[model samples]
Target: MTPPETQGQGSNAATPGASPAVSLCVSTLQHRPDFLRAASALRQGTGGFLLQARDRRDDSPATRVGFTASKKIGNAVARNRAKRRLREIARAVLPGMARPGWDYVLVAKPGVTTIRDFALLLADLQGALARIHKP
Candidate 1:
């Protein structure tokens, strides 16, 4: 007899009657209407960013995120910096916490968004998402 098959016995393989691990996927919202719609749902604030969430009542399987910074934040350099911070925090926090068919808008807050500590900013995004998705 040939050697017992060990190729299917590794930890990564799904055992009998065991469910496989699911991967989280996130996407970016592009259209103007998408941003307009997400503005109407839940809103949460932290020291770094303001988060707005809207649940799209559809059959999509990915979460969508958006970022925005206002002129009030500052000149071109400051506005871009704030947007960059928001984008980084969103990428770090949104995948696992954000549910499918949801749209999230991260608006930069002047004097706070760019200067906030990176760890705190990440935590803020996570906390805001927790509150928004709470039942």
Candidate 2:
């Protein structure tokens, strides 16, 4: 039996006059100062977590994001789980709404971040982002 052919699978199957999809560039924020600076900037709280954002005002054009879960969230395992959820939500939502040259931090809430519904967490992140970006 022959394998079925798929569209846009190989480089040789290029379509005429078609533009490739563009993906937003994003990077992870490291260093304590970056997180502190964002913490002191705009803040928006949602049911799932706290969102902090700051504009770097530099020439770089990539959005940076950081996730943090403190002891208040729980022990090591719980903290890790909370951070993982934050990272997933950021991955799903940040690409569409995050602004270039801005740094964002997602702070996990105790007893909330890990147990909240995934869809609601996503909505919370989206709402928080919208609030922080609003003038």
Candidate 3:
């Protein structure tokens, strides 16, 4: 029920010569044990949040990440917002800097993660990652 010319002109349609977007393959950590292990391994604190990382030392080559916001952040809505910010920062920064077979957890700060400037949050994550991976 659509004309040919308009059929392929949807917003998501790729341009004729534009290269496809390249997205890194990253996994989410869902197990409590995984988070606990990472917590016990390495920790880097930033103004926005706490970054915890652990090398799984397994055969898997995927980088896994987790986000957490405690009740101290506020009620449900505030906690969710903090976690959302953490997830976004992880998504943007982890792909390039995170090592394979590593698990990372981003814990939201009570007053920072939900309201901090986005660029600063990005820098915070990047710096934390650098310090964590340093020898």
TM-scores for all predictions = 0.80, 0.82, 0.83
Please identify model 2 stretches exceeding 4 Å from their true place.
Answer: 1-23
RMSD of each: 8.4, 5.2, 3.7
User: RMSD (Cα, Å) of candidate 1?
Assistant: 8.4
Flag clash pairs in model 1: none
1-135 per-residue lDDT for model 1 (tens digits): 876658777576776885553337677788999998888888998888899999888998888899999998999999999988888877777767889988899999988888889999999998898888889
| Cα misplacement distance, residue 6 of candidate 2 (Å) | 22
Q: For model 1, what is the C-alpha lDDT against the true structure?
A: 0.86
> Which of 1 and 2 is ahead in TM-score?
2
lDDT, candidate 2, 43-126, per-residue tens: 999999999999999999999999999999999999999999999999889989999999999999999999999999999999
Clashing pairs in 3: none
Residue 117 of candidate 1: its Cα lDDT?
95
- Report lDDT (CA) for all predictions: 0.86, 0.91, 0.88
Q: Candidate 3, residues 89-114: lDDT per residue as tens digits? A: 88788878889888899999998889
**Comparison by TM-score, 2 against 3, better one:** 3
